[model samples]
Target chain A: MWLRSHRPAAALMKKSEGTRRDFLRACIAGAAVLGTGGSMELLEAAEQSSALVKSRVVIARDPMLRGAGTTVDSKRALNLLDHAMQALFDADHPADPWKNLVRPGDRVGLKVNALGGHAFSSNLQLVEAVCERLQEAGVKANDIVVWDRDTEELERAGFHISSAPNHVQCFGTDRTGYEEDLVTYGSVGSRLSKILTRSCNVLINMPLLKDHDGAGVSMALKNMYGVIHNPNKYHPNGCNPYIADVNMLPDIRTKMRLTICDATTAMYEGGPAYKPQYSWKNNALMVSRDPVALDYVGWQAIERKRAEKKLKTLEAEKRAPLYIATAADAQHRLGTNDPRRIAVIEAQAGR
Target chain B: MAREMISLADVKFPDVSPINEIARGAELGPRLLPLDRRSFLKCAVMAGAVCGISAFAEPCAALLPWAGGPTQGDSQFTAEARFYEKLQNKKIKCKLCPRECVVGDRERGYCGVRENRGGTYYTLVHSRVCAAHIDPIEKKPLFHYLPGTLAFSLATAGCNVNCKFCQNWDISQVRPEQIRADYAPPKTVAELAKQNRCPTIAYTYSEPVIFSEYLMDTADAGHEAGVRSVVVSNGYMQTESLKAAYGKMDAVKIDLKAFSESYYRDVVGGELKPVLDSLVTLRKLGKWTEIVYLVVPTLNDSDSEFRGLVRWIKTNLGVDVPVHFTQFHPQYLLKNLPLTPVPTLERAKAMADAEGLHYVYIGNVPGHPAQNTYCPKCRHLLVERVGLTTGQILIRKGSCPFCKQPIPGIWHA
Candidate 1:
């Protein structure tokens, strides 16, 4: 029963086989109906009417976008992101969703995951698309910052450091450093990154989808580990409660407005590290307002991929990412992790 | 508004400085005399340096005293670690400490310093000194060894054990890259100790075990330069590595945290048996060892535990071994607890003395009478100490002055 609770329904759907295929077909049909003229306005109206149900996720895929070598097709990736954002906010235009997420005067931070190295990192092309959309949304280029924990990892993952006041800034917490004061939350006591605390008012978590050795999967919630001074202390007991408790911090809970996970290439096993043998091409961009819901979907995607490879499920391996359930617990209530409560709108970009 | 454009080539990294620079600047005194013959001789006499100074008759000007400043950047040194075995899939098991951390590629051990990169283990804090100070040997609380003399104390940025009440948590609980440090090679450390008039180079503040490679190398250099090496540690180390490192040291002071395994697991995040084994090993090796048990109230101050600890020490390490029942102040993560009462320390000391331990003393409370050393044979006071200052040592030629009984310690004749 504990194993069943931790196993995502998507992994369970694989046993039934046709259930997920039928669900995807129904989602595609709904998106097709909404893509018609004037139906976008109806969809926006429906979004407003269903305000009571808050958990929504969008999985936008583009099969042709996977480029050879380490590079991605930037044009196709941008289109995929645009479609994901439009579906996430139920907006008529891509810029409208960005505008709703971040105001023009707000300092926006794009927290990128580069710890997985170049092969399994948040693609640079995806980051560029997000930055471009933010600028189009009327946020000044100078106020947008893309950061990770250190500059070395960012550079290794093909990111250029730019901290000039008049340009789109990119550096790391290593430059700004962590705040001197220690913030205590439950079992967690750490100094927050100044980039998250002082430099940005709005945070866009851009985590890479990968299997984690300790947390079962590194998704939107675990990606916040970069914003703390001591992540090494939280790895015990499968990173449960610690991950959920960290997400509940006021600085993270208030500032994080959206999560756009780069699922272009994911590691279904042996990960948070770049092992080519375990990687697969799952060319998609996942977007959501609820970090817990997005991570739940990402966990399912990893489980599905693992099942395809005939590998054991994370639960079978005794390393299920239980923090997803804890994040949706009564105490934290960060977001909904239940699949039944989440509406995942799946679509193909450039259809 | 028009925005100014800047090219990618023009963008530069912000100047990253070490934290130690700011801390050391406020602490270090003015520069002492240069490393000349007169200064070296004066330092030698003050340090009780009876040997090895004759070899360095000609003072090399290149070997300057520590500038008492921080080192710039994080890429100063990298040494392949000694006690690690390569495992499958580019993983390495660190055999240096009791943790035996099995680290993946590009991932560090629990200590946050030794990393496994491409199937090889490396210590990041090798020669990277984060904190350095000239402290009294009495502060290390080795009352019997070189009383009233100064020790050139230094530490790098990581520790093996995670103690909830760690006083040096800022340095011990962080990775080497997280803090600022200076590159003080083993030779540089020895030269600094000799020039600064410190008889011993103490690897302290943080756990010396995590930086055991640096400690052993510096000890070897200090031996060549006539400076003795000492360690103030938690004693959570593998037997082989512990023997290899502490074998080269003149003395060691181990913090035996408690007598219970559950307290070690819950509070210290370490094992108690390994520490007990290490203490027995130290005694067998005939090292000048001392034990300090900080009596945290309601945590490890029970009479049964104190009697057990004293009985074990008397049986295994002999009754002549010195034990300091130090007071614990609430610190770091354990700040909710009250400061350890002075009476608790006195009670623990009495229990240990009653259990047949010959040299039991109380610490941290200044001007307490138990801070002094007494002869077990004649019941006469051999050494009088207040706080960190030593006054009127009555021992002569490693023996009690009144009873003419030999004491088990490293004493200067």
Candidate 2:
């Protein structure tokens, strides 16, 4: 079941047309396979919803998300995010997804990919929209911490560091350092970031959809490298088993609630960094509960773009993102890479 | 032999540092920068790059206070790795060591110092020297080579092998960017050696094998200015790279680690065969070589292993190769293990002596009797050394004055 095609509209109407209870039941089933254990309590807004989708990836898109050059329409980007969240749980309100996922007392960690700097990193507006929605869902503003690998990197990616008690906190693992103890899974043995271990219990994976020279695609599962201390060591062998193994860590597997992949600008080749000549603006945000599925979709999108440009496929180039399949493999079972098991819910928030 | 330097406008430096800058800036070039020439030296001192010379050049180094040093990493101070095969679609296979790491674009090899970028291989730690010192040739434990003279020692970060009991693991096991490194190019290294009154430039601290390009270029620069080059290494290199790199060396000291393959597998994340092959190749190339075996307690300090090591040395590399059975203190991942007893080192030396080895020494334990170099025929002490200090040199014209037997070493500078 490794086909992540665009069957979200049809599958959403067919699979999510049932009661809200079916959504939780399917999520729990998905969780059992992926080793994700959490309380999936229904929210007030989602409780009255007659329809809900299981493993639904709400893809929010808008041409107005990016203006001229690297500047983005932050307000329009937020609207697109809100629309995606509203569509995710098949609920009327934008706050429904966040309310259903997180508790009021939970410390939510927004792990954003600031590796691409200002050019192709996770947009501040999308991160802000997420923080506001979490606050609306009753999680404390102070409890929501946005972080990456380092403070400089976060700043370079256009995020301001804030540790003010009354505001939504933001910083890096460099501020607190990594855990002293090494967490070992498969061939991966590394110290996890204190931001992931000590500062927050709940994690929201906010990554970018970009072409990776080593891993084929940098998306959901690949973004978890930010939580560990030695991401460099795991890059060999196309980061296959390493990426899958890292996600199996207790905190990452169980605590992570959602993945929001910002695909507003992406690279078809020569990436993991912003190669402006090879980059294209797609202006889309992919929101999903399944990290593996989201990454699979991102890979296909990159592959499609590469094909359009008449470049070699990642497999032909010998840099295929096999980590997606490895994650869904029997040993990992983090999420489904199979499109057959995933339903896409497209939210076209046009200007 | 004036070492030249450049300004910021001459090199490419990025805002995000360490990992990203190296990777992203790879296309711009192979991150190569020399040590501060006259123009860049003033600014380098102002930037707080530690004056590498703790010797005669310390005043010139200035030893300025660091402004956190490098804003995290040197923007472009490296060289193109000499030994690597560019694979298809921007991948590369590092031909430097036995671990022919097939690296994808923007990723590094197992050494973490060499990177591949769009089908080009680059050594990120070329002139990026993180550790530097002025040491006696005896400190490098090359007792046979310019015994009383100083060797300008330097190293960049990263090692091909992970030895559990590595003494210099701090610099040896880290990426170049994790530590602070001064941009000292080949010619600059030669000038520093000569300025510090060091006759030899010793590539040491971290594995010099990982920084083969730097060593080779520095060796050339040193030779051009009449300064010699030596290397202290794990000898875990491919024969071609080893010959191509170490061929420029006036002397070499190799850490043989352990004799058995299992010890290499369990304790060192490398193989014993490649290191052994490197030693053979070094010998064939007629390089002045010394072997140091750090005896770790309960790991590689078995009587059988010692007997096997000396016996193998006698069989292959010959007993004439100076063997030093150094006592090891608990270090790195092997900190839980007790120190190697002095008697254990004595026992290993005794075994090497019985195996018909010409010169065997005990190390790390200062003031030991075996620290003195004795004539094999007459048993008269030729060179007396106490740690990094040379006490007496009784070898005249590369021969023991007492026995009149030719002692195998570069006795005169």
Top DockQ: which candidate number?
1
**Candidate 2, A1-351: lDDT as tens digits:** 111112222333457766776666444444433434442222212322423323567788888776664666778877888888777766687776666778799999999998777877888888988888899899999999999987888999899899998898899887887765556677566678898898888899999888887788888898998898667667766887889999988888777878888887878887776778788988889988788888888888899999999999999999999898999886876777768667777789965
TM-score of chain B of each: 0.84, 0.84
Q: Rate the local accuracy (lDDT) of all candidates.
A: 0.77, 0.75
Per-candidate DockQ values are: 0.32, 0.18
- Model 1 regions more than 4 Å off: A1-54, A67-70, B1-75
Listed in order, each prediction's TM-score against the native is 0.83, 0.69
Residue B71, candidate 2: C-alpha displacement in angstroms: 8.7
DockQ of 1: 0.32
Q: Write the per-residue lDDT of candidate 1 for residues B1-413, one digit (tens) a residue.
A: 11111111112211111111111211222322134554344444422321213222112122334333445455566889999999987888899988777777887777888887889999888888766666668777787799878877778887887788777777788777777666789998898889878889999888889898899999999999999999998999999999999999899999999999988977888999999999999988989999988777788989889988998898888898899987676666888887576678878888887878889987665456787899988999888765555778888999998889998798872
Native contacts, share recovered per candidate:
0.12, 0.16
- Per-residue lDDT over B323-349 for candidate 2, one digit per residue giving the tens place of the 0 to 100 score: 988766655566578757778888998
Residue A265: error of model 2 in Å? 6.2
Model 1 C-alpha lDDT versus the unseen true structure: 0.77
